[model samples]
Target: MLDRPTFTISNVRSGDVVSYPLVLFDGQLHGASAATSVTVSRIGADHPRLRAHTYTAPSQAWPVALDTGVFKALAFLVPGENVIEFRAGAEPVAAIHRLVVHYLNAPWDYCVRAVYVVPADDPVGGFQAPPHERCDIDSAVHRLALAMRLLQSALAELMHRHGLGRYTFCLEEPAQARACPSEGGYEEVLVAYGVPVHVHRFKHSRAALQALSGDELYGRVGQALSGAPDRESRIDVALMSFTRKDAHTGMLYGHTALGGGRLALFGSGSMFSWPENLEQVPRRFTDRTAVDGRRFLDDSAGRGEYWALASTSMGAVLHELGHCLSLPHPHNGGGIMARGFDYLYRLFGVAEPQPGAEMQAPDEPRLDRSAATRLRFHSYLIRAGSEPHPATLYPPHPPPAPDGAVSVPVPSPSPTPTPPRPRLYVATNGLPARARAHHEAHSAPRRPSITWQSEGVVRVSAPNGLGHIGYYLNGDVAAHEEFFQASAPVHLLDIPWREVCRQCGNPPAGAKIRISCVDHAGQIEEAFERQVGDRP
Candidate 1:
């Protein structure tokens, strides 16, 4: 019916060379109400697993309705050029437009592996999900893989927006990649090549998994993957089950976020709500589905429902992945690591689906300057002796990249295997251009049971530009406090007895105060732990 370019792709332009495999096609269908669909087709690239175009939306076979005129879809690219076509109202098509994107798994060979951890006794290879959010193991694999791609694009965009270029985590290839239970590797609809999701069957039973705490499972999972073929090269992104131990409380197990030395492995609960396919992805973000508290893990905690659940569950994984890359929680900002990852939808669509769920004057999730600076030096995204890719060079403008971060290499059209590289981001022996060290000593301190200056204020400060400070109580995964003084490294605070108590309930007796500092060089330092207050 229509002959003009009725489709407009936003996030990217045609002929742009991208480094990552997964790309979110953010754009809108101009004018009127009619059937619309986006199809991915290859131009010159030939991948063993990748076929022509496997992902399509709002199709007769499986309808994934788009958002009004504004819509977004995920496209996994082959080595060379990729052509994504948009069509509406079928044949000769109502309105059509096509865009091309590129990917070369370049200088950075270190990739994030999407791993599915299954207990030996589980039948369907399924975790807990409310009836409204049920998907089989095969489906779960597709969902997780899709989620990783979305995250990859989100990160690339985050870094790019901040003028650091589009750098993101890579995925394992056909060699080390493992397919889920269903087909060997159909990927989503099982027709094209999709990033491999490694499946690891744990020897323990579901009950055993449930019995372990988050930390315990983190260690167990890390140990399991420690014996991997090339353990030091890949950062494991693992998925496991979490079940409620007490019928009265909603506490469950199997949530781990520990990453160091090629080991950033974990995800759980809200995964049930994770979109199972590209079509369902956007909808999943705004998914207003109520999580049946008794059956599924409520990751939203009350901020929102399925939409919030998806954000935290998926975003949390990315956050932990950051930790794996040596990224620490920043001092004061809602960036991904600082718990403001709810804007993943913002990367694609213009609005939120659920009523009252819309984000306004948003506290968006991002990779703040400090995070960008740190990741810039990370070995995972850059090579020590590599030069920058001509096509994707950073724009020499304001908000420049961290020093020594301008030149980075893009993968060749066909990815090649590089020598094994260590996961550590900071150099061990001799120091680099910039040197940083952390020191903490309480002034006029009391005995072992004393912390705090009788005044309620924890002091913190940072170097010229370093910016991630964390406060913890006793020994817990969640940081009870974070002081983000990017310039001055000192900010007073109420000792754990009062301030932290407001956040983490009554900590244990003689609860100790711990602080962590991560500079812009990916260096991590755990400050001294000072005990605060009485044994209440």
Candidate 2:
């Protein structure tokens, strides 16, 4: 067993930067076969409390010199005494550490910063350095810092596209740049990506991040920090920690939403790899799932469903922000309003931008037309001050779905730009529940061109190997469902092989079918004049 480490905290006058030293004395105190990262956070008893203020420069060994980022960002530390808390992973390691934040008295001007690309160095199969060898702890910390900065830049882009909202990124691993010695590469990464970094502890415990409340989370951070000065405003904040476990592949790193509308990411050393988009990262070439997934989006391992990486990784972020905007995914196609379908590239050869790829000057990454519509739909859900929690953003009510899916297929040679339609969803107590795809009928049918299938009682198709199914409903706008009053054409996509069922519970009677869809803008629009005839 290792002796518990002790530390203190002191208050600094506002507008000052403070520094501390982290020492690991026990020679027997060895780092887990992976790199060990640490961070310091402020724990106050208020809404959105427990803010991570400093991330220890990542390292493989203990007892390293400590210069934290949080101190740097808040250049206005007071010279008084304060108690800052120290957390290893997400758990509290040392509470109420006394520290002094002294003013540097240096004049520093600020400007809009951006994220640039950097190269990375490979580390061992795991996060830790080989035992006894000079562990490259400094490089690791710097690398993590750079990654945080880059993500911050991305968040800015997201904010510009969506409305201004406060959010934060939580870390799950020891982010490092070089091995033992900090090198130019690590420096490059830090300078290139300008975001904050945190050392999040990895754990399966339900009590993880017990320090931070729901209001302090991203969804509610804006209101919590609303009183802060504008120049010192932060759009994205990051909280991170680490963990120790015997397994390698047991959910090394993954992100999930907490009940209070908070989101956290957990990962092991093997799960946290050096970043490729940043420079001089000391990461191993091993195929750690988390690292591999991140790496795939990085410089190496390019190709083979790679878009899946970008889509899955960044798609959730987009979706979450979409919810804040009161928007839903486009429901005009054969997919639900919640699922992501990249039709721009699939049809028009307009691929999503590659990670770290640059756009023309003055042009930042903007949501496509479809994505824009989906985002706007969320406007209906924004309750503002109704909820006590800062991050609590929920839909006003559940979407209403009929007995079956009413689909309108996109015509062959897919339309240059898809139109909007009404979508039906399952209603929860008169409120909207999870929305599903209503049938999408093609303006015209093409034989043997594409295939479709009905699963979970919904007819849909597979896009890039993802099965998209829509439900058949009863009260469509054309068919007489309450609140549905539009006469829209119905269609299905890549029509799949299936048996005909009765329309509204009678013998299959309609040579023509009507479908409902939710437009990109979250409106309940409909398409009519669809023909569901017998195929010979």
Scored by lDDT, the top model is: 1
Regions of model 2 farther than 4 Å from truth: 1-192, 198-239, 243-370, 373-536
For all candidates in order, the CA lDDT equals: 0.56, 0.26
lDDT value for model 1: 0.56
Mind sharing the TM-score for model 2? Answer: 0.26
Residue-wise C-alpha lDDT for candidate 1, range 1-536, written one tens digit per residue: 45553777655777667767667666667663554454544443354445443443322121224547666666666655567665655555456677766665453335677777777777667766665556667777777887877887888777666544566766766554544332212211121135677667777787888788777887887777766655555787887854442446756676655665566666566777777776676567776767666656666736557877787778777777887776656545567777666555556554565546554535676876656645653445532111244334423221322442222323321122233222222222112122212211111221012234545554443332233444555543334322232234322323433665544454665766566554433344465465665533
Lowest summed lDDT across 10 adjacent residues in model 1 is found at: 439-448
Number of the top-ranking candidate, with TM-score as the measure = 1
Q: Whole-model lDDT, candidate 2?
A: 0.26
True-vs-predicted CA distance for residue 418, candidate 2, Å: 18
Among all windows of ten consecutive residues in candidate 2, which has the lowest summed lDDT?
A: 20-29
lDDT of 2 by residue, 1-536 (tens): 44344432222222222111111110111222221333433333132211233223222211211322111111112112233434332223221233432211111111111111111323221233223222243344444444444333333233223332211122212232211112232222232222323222222222332234443333332332233222221122222222222244343222232211222222223213433332122122112223233222231223224233222333333334333332333323322124432211111112223334412212223443433333222212111111122122222222333733322211111112124333321121122122211222211121112222334133322111111122233321111111112244233343322322343233244544433333322333333223444333
